[model samples]
Target: MSQNGPKMNEFEASTATEIRMDASRSTSVFLTIYSDFASAEKVWRRFEEYADCYAFQSFDFLDVWYRNIGHRSGVEMQLVVAWGAAAKPLMILPLGIETSKLGRKLVWLGNEVNDYNAPILAPNFGDCVAEGDFSRLWSDILDTLPAHDYVELMRQPKMVGHQINPFTELGLKLNASGTHMTQMSEDFDTYYDEKRTSKAKRQFRSRRKQLNEIGETKYVHPNKVEDIHASIDNLVALKSEALKAIGAPDFLAQPGYLDFYKELSAQSLNEGIGHVSHLEVGGEYAAGNWGLVFKGRFYYLLASYNGPKFGRYAPGLQALVELMRWASEKKATLFDFTIGDEGYKAEWCEIHEDLYDHIQARSLRGVVAQSLTNGFLLAKRTIKQNPKLWALFTKLRAKLANHRDFG
Candidate 1:
């Protein structure tokens, strides 16, 4: 980290919706696109050290994600670095190229696993690139890149570090779901009591009791590599079963995605970047979860349970309860439920953050692809927003999928 880089508060605050067209005299940034990860390693690490970014943009996390998941899926690095006068670093956008039959799409690294995708910006980012200039430079950057049919930027937060996320200026196509989170207290039990209303507390306790009734249940965060491996295996199996049962695409069963989770979990075990833990019933794994802790915030990214055996006990929900408690124990200030409208998330998250997606087509193929993608998303959103429709959808999906009932 630069010893003299601007602190977060020093950066001017801007919103993603509004463009800052101030032509005032200040520094400006130039763009340099790097296709390989290592060429910009030194500066990338330094900015990430003190950058106003969540852990999603962390160097190690994305690096591992790219090698395991992104590369395996045939995505190539197209990291964008913004440099200021004197060659000082301003920001680093870790992006990737994903080619498909429809078109070539540009996306952020850690696309599948990371909850949020953004640039790791130096505190002086806003000072260096006004919204107008930033947009112009972004065009030039794109022009320099190998032709991409379109750009698909998803799950972007409204704010980056201390300032408005520049991308928001692109305009917000509000995601159907928002990121959910809650504040933490010094102690788990105290936090549980203080943060939750009496009714909410009672409901959580009821869920916990159900698991206990199943037998000798406990929250287990493994320390040994072998135990972590065992936990990851159980997590994949449990998560895959639940996802498949819903008639959803079983992406976890894919080799790349599976290996990505295992590698990310094991690698983050000690570094505190990722957490892999499980809940046991009668000393057998019943629920498994994968969480990531970045800076001081905890992200509940992946979770699942033995739905057929433990779903009636609400194992999936209980696992979340345990993770929140665990996060409080570790002094995490915020528990992010990421981007989801799931009822469980609403029950606990006091902060709901609206996310955005930027989809732009550079060619005819991209136009057709973009329309189809948006159409599918619109249909999905319609079902999700209506309770009766969602229920009917789930029921029909399960029968068609031949899913085993948790009950």
Candidate 2:
């Protein structure tokens, strides 16, 4: 039984039961599931009080994200909270239930959108776990894993925390590796000077020259509400056109997704937590980008523009450069080009944090399924690591799996 009164079904994990609580520790009882958004909010709000470094798990952030994406994603969430004196929240695991190929499973509380994933813990709580007392608390928490076939933690940023390591240590099969984008410093002049070689710098300057010589134009990041709306429309049109040309779907073009973003922008701006930037030439919206400004960090989330007209000058690149400069001027601590390992990120990235997809299985069938999945992942990794072998193996595999159903 949990030290806390009773387990909340919404946050219960299916794979594990009977958690062991630590009697020696000062931390109080644990709540298996948060009763409502308000409950989760209370815990998250305290997470900031415990640790400044873990500020991403704040109540305001959770509320905004849940408001925008929760309804459509089909993920049900719960908050795990541990309290101390006067119910000081010490640790939290944001969890959600999702239906995967294996069956119902526990997932990272945040979905694909949030860039970072880890348990929100108190400041200097690192030593608490290290002392081995919190291990019991952790085990108690794990015991609360509802009777699910698997647990999947998708897209973790960095491995410095106990969230990934603890699961693996507890006999769960761990698979840690994913793509990462750059977290460049906030000083634009210094960043560009340090990252751009003489040749690359010269290329950018030359492109600017070509753009100026070709047309009489100007670029601006609009602050007016009306101008921002117009810019968003232009960006969406360009993005839709590009996606259609490539035979892929545009995320912004999804019926409700665009409106969701617009709503998020309005809410974030109202709360002083979002920003939008645009590039205008000849008083027309050429390109636009928008993202969140949370806890002194800037996340570069989305961008779009009319294509090829400024190809020689790379207007998208130009927009990013100017926007980043603007961010630096605003004194943001970090600029996160999140969730991809594109070449552009390499140019200016000083920090490349690896993300991972973690999975834990229950039941005999789930075990076999996990084994097969890991085997396939290992093979994929092998091919990725060796290009020559990858070419040969991929061709054979593609030939074998070539069928209408593969798509």
Candidate 3:
């Protein structure tokens, strides 16, 4: 169990039967399962005011996702809400049920796009869980969930909003990779200098200069409805083409993926839940991007460029620089590159956060599914951690793509 998890004394997995503690103890907790977010939206939002959760867990973000993606894809919401004594809200488990190859699987809402998945916890959740047997609560919650072969809760961090994430204990498998981020100072230049060497800074400036030479370089943040939609559509197209060129399955091709982003960006970007921006060279689109800014952190999300032709001057990186500056101007304290081990992110991240995945079996098929899934994850872990293996894999993938007439 993670050190931050509820106390383990008298804890036996799936043993506790009590769903509600004696109210006199003031640690009583109850769980409710909802098939739709609307049934649980009020408490979910109420907890967000005092809960510790990433921006992705915000009610608005999830609501937008549900309306656009979940409902469209037939992803059923298994939204779990917990209440403490006097029925005070304490936690929200944003879960969903989807049919996977193995069987029906229970997972986090927006798991398809979210870099991290975790339950939003109120400030006093730890105390309540410690006072009550969390094992029993968790067991009851799982028992109440819809039928599923197994559960996969991955990419969960130990800390969220600087508070212990209760899910850390569940996602026992330590991910080989993690999220990348750079903490910002009040001054953008000071922060940039610390992350980049003098030569590297000069190189970046030169790249920007060259791009400028080609045309009047501009970083465009489109707030107008038409511009945002156009920019997002362009970015999606660019990303789709890039994936095709590399022979990778384009997620944009998936049902509701484009709608999820475009609608969210249009409705929530101005509200600070989403952001859409791009870089233009000589009055033409070079790079288009979408990100999230919430609670003083900027989460870098979908980003795409025209191609290596426009990539010559690194317009994507330039846009990031501008984003960093923009974030600093807004007094944002962190610029999160999110979850990727890409070389470009390494150039800017000040910290790397370890991620974890928890897979559990509840049935015979679930057991077999768990074993197969673990094997795949172990292989992925091995490849991700070994530089040579990753290089060889990439080369082999390229060759395979070429053989398949994709290159």
Candidate 4:
């Protein structure tokens, strides 16, 4: 722990709530909160194995994200570990503190970019956390941290594998949008036929024909280091341009964001967590898609295609189709489009899983913050759900972008 950071002594002094499971059960549950990331890293892997952990929660991914983005943004780490009397880890809640417009808030690590968030649970321990246990846990968590406005946990899945998510029992609000995913079939043809209507399939075939006429198109996943770097660079450039064209804030404009993805791509290639796929037209890059493969699931993360030159051929859609086919060929059980409500995603997805957000106030100031934040989120959701309002918002955003660019 850093010299200025909270110490174990401080944590013990602040909150030391003993959790009892049941009268018949002899073991007692205890909580340990750490303000430093290194302490949490020591037990992270072992605890991760106790439950069904997502790739986003892996130490590698979160550490990288924090080092690159979170730390720079002045977010403080708060890792909560629960253990039984036998010294066995039960659950790991990777959380952090940051001062937002609402006030000082405690949130899950990777809350900004992660699609799914939940407390890492021990195997078969999901249903074990009852409301009483959670209430105690929540209180203990608040006690460990400095007085804050709200505890906001967002983008949590309702289930982890076969077990129910214990957090859902705590009564978090349903997120405005849910994640979209498709169950992959045994073969590409079967998956494609199942996802697309006859008309859509015909249109896809026509698009392919047009693309072929332009040049020999090939789908490739770069394996060589140089090739991967080049592909990632191309993706960054394309994505930056696309964001600029639409008048939206360019997330990739920051050097740290670019470096994060580049490092992620390299590390993912090394660890076999994911890969970057590209579509080449006449041996020249036309489109790129980066996705992760974990536990027989393909997670679509980032994708972009060539500009107006290749727009007519629908290179983006073509690349997505090729990616789906690749996932099917690999026998992936699911193709998760992550979080979005785009029309194209709905066309392919059969499963729409609700993500959730939890907001709780600890103090009077927190209640005010919670109310303001809730109202803001509700208004934002209302606008997003209304097509006309969303369209107008986008046009206004684009005009603002243009003014900013030309000013």
Candidate of highest TM-score: 3
Which residue pairs of candidate 4 clash?
A: 50-123
Query: Candidate 3: which stretches are off by over 4 Å?
Result: 1-18, 21-26, 269-272
Write the residue-wise lDDT of candidate 2 on 271-389 in tens digits. 65556677766565667887777666678877877677765567788788888887777777677787655567777776766655566666676676667767876776566556587
Between candidates 3 and 4, the one scoring higher on lDDT is 3
**Per-model TM-score versus the true fold:** 0.87, 0.78, 0.91, 0.89
Clashes of 4: 1
- Which residue pairs overlap in candidate 3's backbone? none
Q: What is the Cα-based TM-score of model 1? A: 0.87
**Taking the tens digit of each residue's C-alpha lDDT, what string does model 1 give over 1-407?**
12232222322211111122343755444455667666656667777877899888887788777777777788878777666657666778888889998899988888777678777888888876766566766676677667899898988998985788888767557666778888887778876776668886687688788777768889899888888889999998877877777788787876677677777778765684878999899898988889788778998888888877777777776777788888887889898888778886766778887877888888999999899878877887788778999999988988878844543
RMSD of every prediction: 6.2, 5.4, 5.8, 4.2
On residues 1-407, what C-alpha lDDT tens digit does candidate 4 reach at each position? 11122233323322344565565764456667667666676678666655677778878778878887878778878777776545566787888888877688888887877889987778746445555566666665577666777888888898876667778767688787779998888878876877789998888789888888878989988777788888988987898899898887788786477767766777766765657889998888899998777767889989999977788878898999998888878878899999878888888888999888888887787899888878877887788779999999989988988898899
Best by lDDT: 3
How far out, in Å, is residue 150 in model 2?
0.9
Reference-based lDDT, residue 120, model 2: 67
- In order, candidate lDDTs are 0.76, 0.61, 0.79, 0.77
